[model samples]
Target: MSKMTGAQAVLECLKREGVDVVFGLPGGVLLPLYDAIYQSDIRHILVRHEQGAAHMADGYARATGKVGVCIATSGPGATNLVTGIANAYMDSVPMVAITGQVNTWLIGKDAFQEADITGITLPITKHNYLLRSATDITRVFREAFYIASTGRPGPVLIDLPRDVTVDEVEFSWPEVELSGYHPSVKPHEMQIKKAARALMDSSRPVIYVGGGVRYAGAHRELFELATKINAPVTTTLMGIGCFPEDHPLSLGMLGMHGTKYANYAIQESDLIVAIGARFDDRVTGKISSFAPRAKIVHIDVDPAEVGKNVRVDIPVVGDAKNALHGLLKEVSPKARSEWNEKTETWKKDYPLRYIPDMNVIKPQFVIEKLCEIAPDAIITTEVGQNQMWAAQFFVHKDPSKFISSGGLGTMGYGFPAAIGAKMGRPECDVIDVAGDGSFLMNSQELATAVVNDIPVKVAVLNNGCLGMVRQWQELFFEKRYSATILGRTSPDFVKLAEAYGAVGLRATKPSEVEPVIRAALATDRPVVMDFIVSPAEKVSPMVPAGATLSEILELEWCDVAQSCHLEKIYAEGRKEVLGQEEF
Candidate 1:
């Protein structure tokens, strides 16, 4: 058999795995791998920071439903990838992270740029390896990709020691084997029947979808099941695109800053058909009180998540697509005319609202306009008010369209993510709906986009503060603003974009909102459009921390309480739940 260096084998394995592009930064021990990359046909994106590389890879994977690859060196370079690795793990995005380690001989001697990346990322990765020899290189890479892209997809790390990378080994592809890593692709017949029975018996049922629906390519099955059951569907923040937002069955997003109708529906549900969703605390609110009366039918690929959060009456541990496909056959079409009418009334009564200001632009208005202009665009968001507004206003027509940092809630995720999305799908329009605070966290990526000629657009809702934190301070802390205000140190975004050799535009008035967004979209180069918005604007339909979904507060709800001088919002929520007038 022909022989090749471990670095060359890595390239060969990547090519075999269909990896055409990778996002990463170069460092000392990574030079050999970088050299291999340079000599190969594979394209490598040079990110400004190692964190951006990880997020970019994540974004690409989310957009394409494929395994994304990212590389970093040892020490700080490997450490910087930790947050992004965790972000992928939480969101169930498929990614393989490669880190160059110091020589195996110097591993414990604290050599220069040495780090135990495998150990560092143990909790955040589905699996990780510390290569001891060049002979293990091919097997390690094959296993990493296999583990990363299967089951409940997540990041996998392969730590390559410098000596192992340069050493010569046989060039044959190794067969991947893992005895304890079998993921069930089929749902249990008995459990699926039980879930179907639960759905048919309940008049007030709701389908709760999460990121797994998108990861498993189960959107079609989810839609079929929801329609067959005639159940109201409420998606988690990560599940935004799993169901079409404009569908009659859709309750939009639920929990925290979720829509009023969605939170109310969950509070009143008798049966919750949770498909591929881990009942996260953010979605559950107070765990004990959430969906208090509902009998849960949990379906997930990961067995550990079945009864880990809320208890489930029927648990089907299998791939979401397969489970949902089987469920569609076992369940008969259900009709809950009364339940539908009630949810419709709630949706009409408590619609998402923002006051129109002729003097200044509203963040929601900008998001709506972008949705109108780019209806088919792939949208990404940083964590905060901007994320909520985009989730509320921007209608995602299909899965793999709405990408955001949901589980990890990373602020700097959107910009670099948009770049990766653009690279993954050059035909589709990609946009990052960002907050001023979050945009600045990785604004350096604008250079990466411009340099690569990736034409992704960014809309920065410049409220001159960390809008979400300031909103909380406004509501809970008696408006005692602390470090949340960013106006004093906020950079001029238009100037910043221009310095990065990107197109820059600003919108100060409501009239300029549409024009600015259109102009940004028309540009063939990377563009950053800064929309100066009101500081007082808050994402409404909010459920207070540690409170039940019944305690959702909206603009009108907040106004009424403020006028009545009420000390607690729970009192108002109690009245509403009792069918009393809200105001």
Candidate 2:
């Protein structure tokens, strides 16, 4: 083993793990680490804020399927990374955030810039470390990456004190061996068979997919099982890209803002072959009424998540990939023609549509144009109405094509995430589908993109207010517009983009949406297209808060007949459409 400073050992360990890039900001405490970074071959993208650094890393991990890394200084710097860390954790994105602490001797004394980062990030991180000694640096770095990338991947943090970085130590990479950290990746034979039997027996089966399927990279297996069993597939928001939306069996998304037909299909199904999914509250509105008729067969890597939110008739605790493999072997091909016909009718009855008004731009129209023009772009979204619109309009034909903050629903996440995703896969085009309010939260990242020459395009849905909140208030609170509108105070997005040395374009009319999006996609320099969409436009196919799927609402603008809400099949269609097949 060769002797080196802890800072050098950090770089060496990263090299061993095949890490090529990192996103971070430097401070006084990180001097030694930054010095080592400067001398090393690893590419470091300097970020405007520690939060941007964390999000960029998260985006990088999601795009490349590798553990993304970021670094920051102590106190405020470490604290700035908290939201991003939590975003990654809630979404199960694999990341490792490194922060430099004050000298070890100054540890409980509350030295300047000192804060307990380990304590702050405990709940959000899969695991974290506070370096005890310089000698432990090698193992810490090694284990941090291992933990971050494996077993239902999530963020992990490493706190490096200044003294530890400067200390000299002999570095030797040790084999990772935790006493009780084995993740169940292989499913039990009996459990897989039982799940297979349940799935095969159900007449009306629906596959409910989650982000776990994306993490396990089991889309092929998932596809095979669904096709073999002749089941319709509905995905959660996080599960959007995992299943091909263009496929005949695909039922886009289901839940509060999901497609009406998907929600209908789920409610009518007799069996839910759930794969890598958690029954989040948003996906299961009014829990008692959710899938009231369906028995569940859950396959997941974490045992705790299997029955945490919903009851499971057949539970297979293992990685989604392995479990799917086992199910594929046990189950044979079968055609549920009656169930297929019902899904098609549901799809036709409640298609996602809107009035074609050339007067004002609609967010959904813009997203559809972007998808048509740049079908292969890796799309990331900032939270709000824009997030929902992207989820609804963009047809994700492949896995990893769409990224967003699903659980935490953090605003200001898309732009930086686009930057990180671009860095990880420079060959692919990256676009941030953002709402104006959410875009402004981290708008300063435009400078980061310009300086680094990262040409990540952004489509800003400029509704002139917090669109989602405004919709909620209008519907439920008598339109008492509080701190939502950024009317007169909103900055001119074109000027803002120009000031940051990036190209800016604006589309006010419906006719300009497609051309503007095409222009942004064509530009080599970073471009932000501000589509001045109508604030009056709202996301349809919504199941109101705490309401059952049977009570879904739609806007008259969506249908040619000016329909306000479509009656669910339970009342009039299911029995007639499916020849008396009852759930």
Candidate 3:
């Protein structure tokens, strides 16, 4: 066997693991790896910020169902990736983050660029490795990739010392033999049978799906089982497109801002077949009251998540597709005419509705117009109001169509994620649905788009404030509006786009919305549209925290007309009816 440098070992390991592209920024400590990368076949994408690199890797992993890879150097470079790593950890995206560390001798000595990245990222990663020797390079990489892409997929870190990357060792890529780290891919047979039995017996069963189905590539299996059993489906925010929103059985998204009918169905169902989804607090609301009457059959790839939050009558731990297939075979279909009728009643009563007033421009209207113009376009969104609005208004017909920071809810995710998604699927039109606040956080990436000649359209909802938080403060905190307003004299986003060498448009009136969006789409260069929407608008049908899913408060048309002054209307109307005698 020939002697190879640590950098060569890393490249060999990545090749063996089938890593095609790496998202990263190079630095002094990682010069050896960069040198080897120059000679290797793997492609490297240099990002503007290290955080952007990590998020790009995350987007790639979520879109392709592969373990995304990212690299950064010691100290500050590594520290910059912390937010993205945490984002991946929260969402359980499969990724491998490799960082260069100071030489082994200087690790604990507070050397110029030294930081304990492994220690810093321990809570946010599935596992982490600190490589002290050249021999450990190959094994650490193999282990990191395996852990990242396997069961309960998450980010894993491998920190390499600068000296180690240049050191020479005998090169022989050994097959990984992890005796102590076997993941449970096969669900227990008894648990599978129990789940099957539950499905067979229930009359009012609804399948709740989430991102795990997408991760496992089990969309077909999920569709097959749901169709076979005639069970209506509801999805968490992460599971939006796993089942097509237009499907007859699909009840759209369910959560804080979920459809009223979807939340009601969960309340009334007798059996909830939750597949590849966690009962996140956002979805469940109050654990004690959520789906109070329903028996749950929770199936997931991770055993630890089986009963982490909600109690499960049946728990199946395996690949979601495989386990679902096993259950389908065991269960016999049952008739449930009454249950279907009840759900249909709820659907008709509380159908998703938004008034399109010609006088004032609405955010939902812009989203709908964009959807009409670019039906198959890929969409990335920042967190908060824009994210929820996209989920509510956008119609996604394809899998991997909508990319956003779901679990992490990272604010500045849209622009860079759009860049990465565009890079991954270049033929498709990619757009970032961003709020003004979130857009400013990563607006710097417009330079990256302009430099690469990537024609990503950014639709900025310039509401002049943090709209979502302002809504909360308006409703719950007595309209104090603390630190929520962007105030007057906002940055000239159009001029900013022009300065970055990208096309810009401003849309204020409702009539200008579609024309501006179409203009952006017509461009072959990066474009940003400053869509000035109504600042007073709020995402309605909000379910308060620690409340039951059924206890949703819908903001009525009258409420909107009164500018959220519901108490005054209530007092006046009731007093008039009662002749003020009771008072």
Candidate 4:
């Protein structure tokens, strides 16, 4: 054991945990910690805001499957990290956020720049700490990383008071032992068998996937199980990159703005083999009507999630990879020819499409071009229509290729996230698909990018308004468009990019989309490519709020005709099966 200041011990602990980089900002209270950071070999990316640091760490974690770290000062600095912490918490991203507090003597005295960061982040973090002594520094850092990266991974905070940082103590890493925090990693044999039997007996089975599968590194097992059982696979928004969308059984994303085929397939399936998926309201649409005909076999690491959203016929609570391994033993290969045929018909009937208009560029067309240009790039998205469009148009074949804020749906997440992703995977292409309103939120990060020489690409879908909210206003609220539009006074994104010493390109027509995207991709410096898309264009096949999946509304008549035709085919098939076979 060696004697050292708490700040030095913190850096040492981080080094032990394989943390090479941190995203953060410094303040008065963090002086000692920043001094320690400066002396250490660990790379620190100075962010414009504490919130950006949190998001950058979150993005780093999501991209690399490693625990991300961020630091901030007390009071407003700590508070600024709240939204990013909440975003990571809601999406189950593994992160550790450290904040410096005022001196211990000043505690509870309402000192300047003093606020209870631990209390403020209580609801958003998996676990948090308030360091009362230098002696506990090693233990706290160890536990923080452990808790942050463990089962149901999420953001964990550690508050370091100024006195604690300056105090000297002999340190030794403690053996982590916590009584009520064990996560189940093994499934019951009987439960696995029972789930297998259910899947075997069902004529129409669909596998519903979520982010947990990716987090647990269970995609291999998940893929094997689905392929062996000949079941169609539909993923939640968070699960987009977990399954190969190009696969024959891939139904792409389901629910809300999910593919028409996926929604229909889930509604018609007899069995839902849900893997690491929570039945979020967006995915389920109307809960009462969602998968009304199906029995669900829910496999998750968290026992609390088994029946929290929907009733499960078989609840196997364990690590998703292990649970999938258990199921693989009991499940046998079977040709689901009829079910496959139905899904194929659905796929053929309603494909994601848009009418070609050369005058005004459609956002979907831009995304399609991006897919063609950099199919293997790490794609992050800002919330709203850009997110939905990215989910729909981008074909993600590998896990971790797509990252976004799902549960919280935070805007301005993608750019910083892309930066973090680029930092984590320098060789891989990192692109942030963003909206104009969302991009402007954290666009100041352009300075961070240029300063650090992190060449992340940004695709701004500029519609001159908050397109998603405007769509809602147009459809449901009688076009009472509230403070959504940015108007003509909005800053020119290309000029703004130039101001940041970054390349900026704009595409106004349909033909210009591909070339502009290509130009952005070719740049070695950070590039912001703004595509001025139509303000009137809306996401199609939308299931209106409070509506069931079957009641999805299509933007065009051709889509309506196709959906109707698929329903007719299904009705006829059901009648034939009822009259003749036991299927």
What's each prediction's TM-score?
0.95, 0.95, 0.93, 0.95
What is the C-alpha local distance difference test score of each model? 0.88, 0.89, 0.85, 0.89
In candidate 3 the C-alpha lDDT for residue 285 amounts to 94
* Model 2 worst lDDT window (10 residues): 560-569
lDDT of 1 by residue, 411-484 (tens): 99999999988889999999999999999999999989999999999999987778899788878898776777
Q: Candidate 3: how many backbone clashes?
A: 0
Question: Who is ahead in lDDT, 2 or 4?
Answer: 4
- For residue 314, model 1's alpha carbon misses the true position, in angstroms, by 0.7
RMSD of candidate 3 to the true fold? Answer: 6.9
Writing each residue's lDDT as its tens digit, candidate 3 over 1-583 gives 7898999889988998898888888998999999999999998888788888888888777767788898999999999999999999988889999999998988899998888999999999999999999988877888888899998899999999999999998877667788878878788888888888888888888899988888888888888888788888998877878888877788888879999989998998999988889999889999999898999998899888999999988888888878887987887765656877887788788876677777667888889999999988888899999999898888875558788898779999888888777777778898899998999887887877888787889999887778899888878899877877773236788999999999999998999998999899988999999998766677877798888999987865433553334334334545665786766
Q: Against the correct fold, how does model 1 do in TM-score?
A: 0.95
lDDT, residue 165, model 4: 91
Candidate 4: C-alpha lDDT: 0.89
lDDT of 2 at 108: 82
Inter-residue clash pairs, candidate 3: none
Model 1, which residues run further than 4 Å from truth? 556-583
